[model samples]
Target: MVKLDNVDRGILHELQLDARNRTAQEIADKVDVSASTVRNRIAELEGDGVIEGYHPKIDYEKADLPLQIMFVCTAPPTERSEMVDQILDIRGVVDVRETLTGRRNLYVEAVGTSTTDTVRISDSMHAMGLSIESSEILRQRQVQPFNHFFFTDPYADGDDNGED
Candidate 1:
């Protein structure tokens, strides 16, 4: 495990907030460090695989592919990990998750333009020998950065004396 100092945590928090638009200098300002330090720390984090990759928060509905479905299935405990790559290969499959539990151990999320697309995904999974327990249409998903790395607003302070 990589040891992260307060500055590293601060940098990670700021980056999680808006990695694409927030520059190193902006993170440095919030972390009370120099831009160079922020950049170097980010490099170290990436090399250590702590920061895997940046992903956009896409709105599939706005993109005109509104059908988002989650498939909960049960696979042989020993085969779940091996199935990840194959399941991902299925068109429209966006995410696959393996759980420690025995029943309903495999979860797959997929996007589609129509009901036929969803049916095709189900047929593919069935062909792969997966028992689909349930398929639900996902309404929404929300995400937030880990709160352990949370920081107070840079402009907010202990001295809260009637200020907007």
Candidate 2:
């Protein structure tokens, strides 16, 4: 694993908040280092794949993609690859997950310019031999990183339900 010092961690934290705002000079000022040092550290982080490429967080409403759909699907064992390929071909699909649930084994998150686009994607999935268990338009009230839930323990040992 790549080891990060406190400075590196702080750099990452600040970048995560607003990747586009701070320059190497500003980051260096915040971290009390030379600008060249900050640039080199960022380069090192990128080279090590710690810092992936940056992206602009686009507002879907302003972008004309107001509809967001989550598709829950099940693929036949023989058609799994075909189903996945079809889903990847869809224009607006942002993310897809192979879920543990046997019935709705795949989950897809897609954004579209209209409800027609969402329905078209869903229909295409069904035509590709994937069973569409259910689909719903997602009205995102708030978005949180999945790592927040997965990395932290939300309950104590005493709160166990004794499933194991």
Best candidate per TM-score, number?
1
TM-score of each: 0.90, 0.71
Give the poorly placed runs of model 2, Cα more than 4 Å off: 75-86, 98-105, 144-164
Q: Provide the lowest-lDDT 10-residue window in model 2.
A: 155-164
lDDT of 1 by residue, 55-120 (tens): 999899999989999999998888888988999999999999999999899999999999999999
Question: How many backbone collisions does model 1 have?
Answer: 0
- Give the winner by lDDT: 1
Query: What lDDT tens digits, residue by residue, belong to model 2 across residues 30-103?
Result: 56688898888899999999998888776776788898888988987565655676688888987787865567
Clashes in candidate 2: how many? Answer: 0
Deviation in Å, model 2, residue 114 alpha carbon: 2.7
Q: What Cα-based lDDT does every candidate model obtain?
A: 0.87, 0.73
Question: What stretches of model 1 exceed 4 Å from their correct place?
Answer: 150-164
Residue 73, model 2: Cα distance from true site in angstroms: 3.0
